[model samples]
Target: MVTAALALCVRTGAGAVIAATVFLTVLSVTLGGSVLADTPLWLPAMPAWPLTATGARLPVALVLGALLLTVSTGLAHRELSRAASR
Candidate 1:
């Protein structure tokens, strides 16, 4: 997710940095294998503290996806602005 965000940021202004940070952090946690188990697909389940499970990773992935989409949109807008300025 962070990679996508970085790509987006490359075109967009620095405004995307916050979103990138949030996404990358969440992704790192998820990929680290520390989250709740048996979480429903629709809801963000709060995993028990100090627990580790694949189910817990879903929320992080979802958040990261959202961040990626947002950053990509921003990048598109930035590119458009640049083109218009030229």
Candidate 2:
């Protein structure tokens, strides 16, 4: 959700861009264990895991969520800017 929201909010008014970004993120995550798909590693720094393990998924999600929240909060202009938009 954070990824989707961030991508959609920051891109150049291109809805397809965000959709593609999320689609690629999910697709790459599934095809983990490769050199390119290193977002979510299942192993302990040896190979990519891609949210297959709870240990990897939990921490990644936590940190990513925190980072996204911080960015949106910092960039938002109004109180409702980050929470809601047209």
Give the TM-score comparing model 1 with the true structure, all chains together. 0.36
Q: Can you give the lDDT of residue 68 in candidate 1?
A: 61
lDDT of 1 at 38: 40
Candidate 1 deviant stretches above 4 angstroms: 1-54
Model 2, residue 70: distance off in Å is: 1.7
Q: Model 1, 1-86: lDDT tens per residue?
A: 34445556656656776776666557545643443234332233222212432466657756755776798677666766776798
Candidate 2: pairs in clash: 40-50, 41-49, 42-49
- Angstrom error of the Cα, residue 63, model 1: value is 0.6
Lowest summed-lDDT stretch of 10 residues in model 1? 41-50
After superposing candidate 2 on the true structure, give the runs of residues whose Cα lies further than 4 Å from its correct spot: 1-11, 29-53, 76-86
TM-score for each predicted model, relative to the true structure: 0.36, 0.37
Q: What CA RMSD would candidate 1 show?
A: 7.6
User: Cα deviation of 80 in candidate 2 (Å)?
Assistant: 9.3
